[model samples]
Target: MNPPFDRLLADVLACRHCEALLPEAPRPVLQCHPDARLLIAGQAPGRKAHAAGKPFADASGDRLRDWLGLDEETFYNPRRVATLPMGFCYPGSGRAGDLPPRPECAPRWRAALLDALPAVRMTLVIGQYALRWHLPGSGSVSEAVGNWRAYWPRPAPLPHPSPRNQLWLRRHPWFETDLLPALRAEVARLMEDPAA
Candidate 1:
């Protein structure tokens, strides 16, 4: 790993600033490299991801990879893509679903970590928290995702690619027909040679 990135990652890995507040012990999870061209930002690690010590280690990840037109090897290749979330640890479940990512995470670590990724040409902001942080507005996930072009060529808001959102996917025919084609083409181009 590059020294600066290695240091930043080490710092993140060692972080336990909110361990006391977390339901379980802190276990930050993510994959990244300074050379990455595609940045996939999501809400936070889920229970499966936390246990696996990697981000997106469940059906959600499988769906996410499919959405990006990527296979596991390519999607997990840190040199080509970076997977960072709004929070690094599992925030535990709530009556509705997984609770919102901890309030402290972004304020503490977001900027410094993002700065390490100078080569990221496009950022796919997944779910509400990621969208709020990356593309601030009162707009709902559906609205921001639909208005993706407004933030084109840099950060694009997307609905969470969870199986739970299967209904949403069914409802939004345009996401598949309109946005994904362009998104995939860009990903394919970026994968050819991120260093370019």
Candidate 2:
């Protein structure tokens, strides 16, 4: 973390705007740096990630790492890869799964965080919420991801890597056959670039 990011991070961690409504106390989980070339814009933290105080600390993260063809070291390295969720804290669970990210998080904090990391070459927009935010009017996540080529060099929209999405994955073989490989290649290129 650079000086400005360090300060912003402190503020983010200290945030409690939704404390009264939150099931658990806020523990904003994220990784960032002044020199990150790639950003993973995911949904809110899950139970495990919230407990761990780290983004992508669960099975979903493991799958995402595989998709990017990245080892833990490279993926967790803040200078190379950054993880910023639409909602920084866990939004608690619902009947089906985790609830949507808190409505206030993105509007309050996203711009500041993005500004702190000026070297972001590309953002991996993961899950429905992030896709909606990054590629507005692009329709559902499936449609946005199916036409991922349209958003290249700026953002790459992807589905959530949670185990719950197994059915979607099974239905969309192209995601594995075509998109994953392309995503890996791009990630490699960006991560390998010294200038980035």
Candidate 3:
């Protein structure tokens, strides 16, 4: 992170545009670097991640890493992977699950943050909010994901890796049977490429 990028990131970290709607003091959790090759664009921090001040530090992260065939060292490496959720802080829980990321968060910050990462080669969009942002009007998560190849080697849509989605995974057997292997291969290639 250079001085300019550092300042940009600092601004993002200090964001509180939706502070009133969050579950706690805004503890924006994310990872970024100018050299990052893969971008993990997600909805927001889960309660566990908000507590840790780290993105994707829960069981859902475990499954996401498995899907990408990434070890923690590689996944957590800011130089290699960057994580920027729609909302940086935890939005609180609801009867269905975690609330949708605070609607105002991304519009205010995403573009500038994205501009800081010049080396991004691929993006893994997780859950509905991310899809809506990254691939608007692309249809449901399943539909966008089913059309993943069209975006090929970048911007792959994925269901949230929460255990709650076990049924979704079971229902969409082709995701594991097809997409995971391809995604893993690209991940390995990016991790190995020196320029990336």
Q: Relative to the true structure, how large is the alpha-carbon lDDT of every model?
A: 0.89, 0.90, 0.90
Residue by residue across 1-196, what tens digits does model 2's lDDT show?
2677788988998999888778899899899988889999999999999999888999999999999999999988999999999999899998999999998999999989988988999999988888878888888999988999999757889999999999999999999999988999989999887774
TM-score of 3: 0.97
lDDT string, candidate 1, 80-190, tens digits: 889989989899998888888888998998898899999999999999899888888838999999898888768978889889999999999999999989888888888
What's the true lDDT of residue 189 in model 3? 89
* Candidate 2 TM-score versus the reference: 0.96
Which structure is stronger by lDDT: 1 or 2? 2
Error of 2 at 59 (Å): 0.6
Which digits, one per residue and each the tens of the lDDT, describe model 3 over residues 20-130? 777799988999999999999998899999998888999999999999889999889999999999988999999999998888989888999898888999999999999
Count the clashes in each prediction: 0, 0, 0
Off by over 4 Å in 2: none
True-structure RMSD, every candidate: 1.3, 1.2, 1.1
